[model samples]
Target: MYRYDQYDHLIVRERIAQYRDQVARRLNDELTEEEFLPLRLQNGLYMQRHAYMLRIAVPYGLLSSAQMRMFAHIARKYDRGYGHFTTRQNIQFNWIELEQTPDILADLASVEMHAIQTSGNCIRNITTDEFAGVAADEIMDPRPFAEILRQWSTFHPEFIALPRKFKVAINGAVEDRAAIAIHDIGLTLTHNEAGEAGFKFMAGGGMGRTPIIGSVIRDFLPWQHLLTYTEAVMRVYNSYGRRDNKYKARIKILLKALGVEEFARLVEEEWQDLKDGPETLTREEYDRVAAYFAAPAYAALDNIDPLAAHADSKPFANWLQRNVKPHKVPGYAAVVLSLKKTGVPPGDATAEQIDFVADLADKFSFGELRVTHEQNLVLADVKQADLFEVWTLAKSKGLATPNIGLLTDIISCPGGDFCSLANAKSIPIAAAIAERFDNLDFQHDIGDIELNISGCINACGHHHVGSIGVLGVDKDGSEWYQVSIGGAQGNDSAIGKIIGPSFSGGQMPEVIDRLLQVYVRNRVEGERFVETAQRLGIAPFKEHVYATPISKGELVGEDHA
Candidate 1:
């Protein structure tokens, strides 16, 4: 993890002071809600259903153990003892008083963390693959470049406000876990034929009212030209991106309106002007940034029997098998701390659990924690020797759920409970599905299933990326749930299909169960749920969910099978 340098410290402190004054002015009625809205959002604070929600940025989804403990401290002391990790790899604290947000910001600053750029229509958080440095398939660590982008975009005068929100994700791994195609700007770092590092640029991708995968506008953008090329991309977008209507304001709509070739030509024209500017990253600066993200030294360990460890019904072994993945280092495994426990809301980690995870990270793994873009926490460099110990400590805190990549490991948003835009509750639906799939072995057997839940169609829950997506819709005055199937995340990103008409909240679990059961029965041997779905399409699962009879008092669509 990069420790904040003097320049970093000074700028962040100044920003915090500025936001504090802005918040104070708003509370004193000096600024109207309309005027304060953007300012507050820029600081990662939102006026929500019950109270203000404060989103804390975890840069590149990386946090030190000390930072994690500070988060737990703030959650316990100021707000409720709970925080919600988000799909964008940030954490949100609900129930915060608007006036107290500045204090929270100050506390976050103490740990070299702040929520700036987490929201509003500027370049938001620069995200990357969850397993950036240590993934076996990674060509290089993407965080250094992510950090470069973060610094370049933070309060950059020209792009303070755009026509609409913009996002950027980078991945160096052959497997794209960052959902690069679904970002406003996506960069995949790879080596060129001459063995020089570079980025492949994709533009006009986003998810919201409209969902479209990004197009590769520029390939082989040299390493030194990252900032300049991106500056060109942003300048083109800022100049020509739509601003007429909020719905039509996204860069995706603009790119769609202009053909990809024309868009690429425009960006090229813009880049030609800004190609050799001061913004271009020099070899020295690149090395300086990369130095901060070099992997920590790990002690060598002997590999033991991989199967014999599971004989004693080691509760942690089940979790390790499902959630942990092989590390580039031979004796280590990347540990995923799943927040999707049955009956508990997805991505909700209490203060105690947060503290426990932080402690576990220090004791068994590196003294760092990573909040993944998929709304889960990761201990990225745990040695294989320490897996059992880490699992026990995690199990003690109810964080040992083994349902990773399964139907139960749902991704949910702070739906009606917090988001004013949401039509219904999301937590309960996620809980219901998780409980239904509580049978651990069954969930593992299902394998690599993604179940996403959103309170509404805003798609904050990443419904567009789930194998089974649950979207909340309002009919008249009641809440109804819609299901989408066949979506996937990772290197192959695809939007889900709406299975049928919406169902009442009560029918959600059974419908999900039926969907999974259909998959279980129809899938050929050794086929993953996603592959099975692709082979057969949503027809089979959709048929079963629609055909199944529901209990009395449950709402069903008129066109039921």
Candidate 2:
């Protein structure tokens, strides 16, 4: 819930005005699509398969109730009446008109939001954990640092163009909810032996043609030098990162070619000029930014009695156990609004649901909301005593699917339905899997599982992170999905191992059922799917899935059918 200062306000307003004129010029045919490509991309506009998609930056995934309401307004006014929340913790409006875009940008500016850095090959939105301010295990709130980076990168002359799209993620918590390890630059706040805060600077991570996990470039970059050090990295990348081939353009690719030692030497040389520059965090700037994200007021209440009583009385006790996260404050509970309902696409919240979330944020969580890296919205500080009341309101809004962090809490892309690059419909695949695992009691007992579906190999859905990753590809124009297993997000992030031959759309759900059956049958009594699969490898599951069951046609014994 960071507030905009006068300077911040002016820059956003000016950007909107600038983009508005540019949009007008494009419509007037003064600028061709080729000429306007970079211009529109700078403002987060993209010409996707079916329509123009506008991605609006939600810095660090935090949203004020008012700002979120503005998203609802935009969704209702332009394009379809819904927006897709993405893995990068931003929202996308597909089916946008060329002309109405500027008006939408103006409206977003009014609410202190913008489309800048949401597209193009420059520094993108700086993402952190959704529970930064309220998580029980946080070392410190990450938003102040995120905001500082925003100012440093936004419209900065030097970084206006880069070799490729750059991403940065920061994490200050024990659990790496921000997926920091897989970003272009990852910063984790940690304490040194001297008991002072600094960042564990990770470099060279990205996903695309070549996926990589970042290596530790600087073991402990002092907190005061955070911005200056970051600028050093960007400088090193801009000066030497590849521009020859788009495929080999990311900082990660450069780092891979140069080797970590040589890259670190280059960064060290660059950092010498910026150890005490203007972008370095001063006490005044730190205090000013930190003031905006000071923790919310909470009334002390006993959670033990009320939560125990509710747990005993409620049918959603299983849900309460899986979806609800612990809050830093004693009596507050961080509630996740699950979009992963049975027979519905995961992470696809309707426009009505957006408004409801805004309302609930205003009423229940101090007028603040957060979108999770897992593609869900969160009321970060709901009182434990009001869990039932919050659940009731959420149920009416169709946000009461109790599958957060479970197998059904799948991550997916628009697939063939919305993506031009997609060969298959991913949403339907997500729905079919969710429907297969609809039983709450079963899910609770089954434990945590991740299912990621992408329409293509572009991996927009982060299929590399899912426990069972499904990637759609075309085999002679028929939609086929390739399966991978044992992928994980968080601290030990790893890309999944591919199983075998791909399956058609109709065979997708059946394949998933077979995979789950293998997990269920082979697992130790209390073992989770991820653990069991990791322990036993994908061979067992692969064999079961490819096996022709009783439901499938078989050859006759005497004569071939």
lDDT of each: 0.84, 0.84
TM-scores for all predictions: 0.96, 0.95
lDDT of 2 by residue, 458-541 (tens): 678888778899998898977778898988878978878889988766667678778888988888987877778789998898
- Minimum summed lDDT over a 10-residue window in model 2 is located at 552-561
Highest TM-score against the true fold, candidate? 1
Q: Report the Cα lDDT for residue 1, model 1.
A: 80
Cα shift from native, residue 258, model 2 (Å): 1.6
State model 1's lDDT: 0.84
lDDT by residue for model 1 (149-266), tens: 9998988889988998888999999999899998989999998899999999999887767878889998889988999888888888899887889898888998999989999999
Candidate 1 — which pairs collide?
A: none
